[model samples]
Target: MQMYNPEVLGVSLRHIQNRQERRVCEVMTAELADDEDFCGCTLCIEDVYACAMSRLRAHYLHRVSIVLKRPPPNDLEIREEVCAAIEVVRLRPNHASVT
Candidate 1:
């Protein structure tokens, strides 16, 4: 399956968002950037992202006003999940090798 990008579709779905997803994306990007040995291919990156996202709790905010009232996710938790995801994808990547 392909990763979803609303920007690529030229559409915005800003009405609702899983707060954990944004955190996962940020943490995953930083973690992978620091790991030089890890495969940064599209498949690997998407796998890592998917893996991380699945491990985190989903906190959906349907309105911008609610976002301000909600407590943000813990940074340490996000880091831990992202790190674990990195290892999982690294050990068992979907593809044999990057082209």
Candidate 2:
């Protein structure tokens, strides 16, 4: 039996990351920037980020991969997820209201 070693294959395991993360962050940033009412506290922001990431399908990839054959999620879809996440966090924020 042979054990799989990414290092031997010239690929680092740490290089693996969800491709959707970048898109999600971009969309979320835009959405948040436009909404002045949304909480800007650390906890609220973190919660919204986590919630949005959870709802979207993860497209993981190795940094070494040259091409991504599959198309990424639609822009509208990502916006919808980020919007919903913001609403969820706003309605039931974990931390108390901050002055």
Q: Which candidate number has the best lDDT?
A: 2
Query: How many clashes show up per model?
Result: 0, 0
- Pairs of residues clashing in candidate 1: none
Q: CA lDDT of each candidate?
A: 0.81, 0.83
Instruction: Give the Cα RMSD of candidate 2.
Output: 6.3
Give the alpha carbon lDDT tens digit for every residue of 53-94 in model 2: 899887778656657676667889888998999999988999
For model 2, name the residue pairs that clash.
Answer: none
In model 1, the Cα lDDT at residue 63 comes to 54
Looking at model 1, residue 88 earns an lDDT score of 92
lDDT of 1: 0.81
TM-score of each: 0.74, 0.76
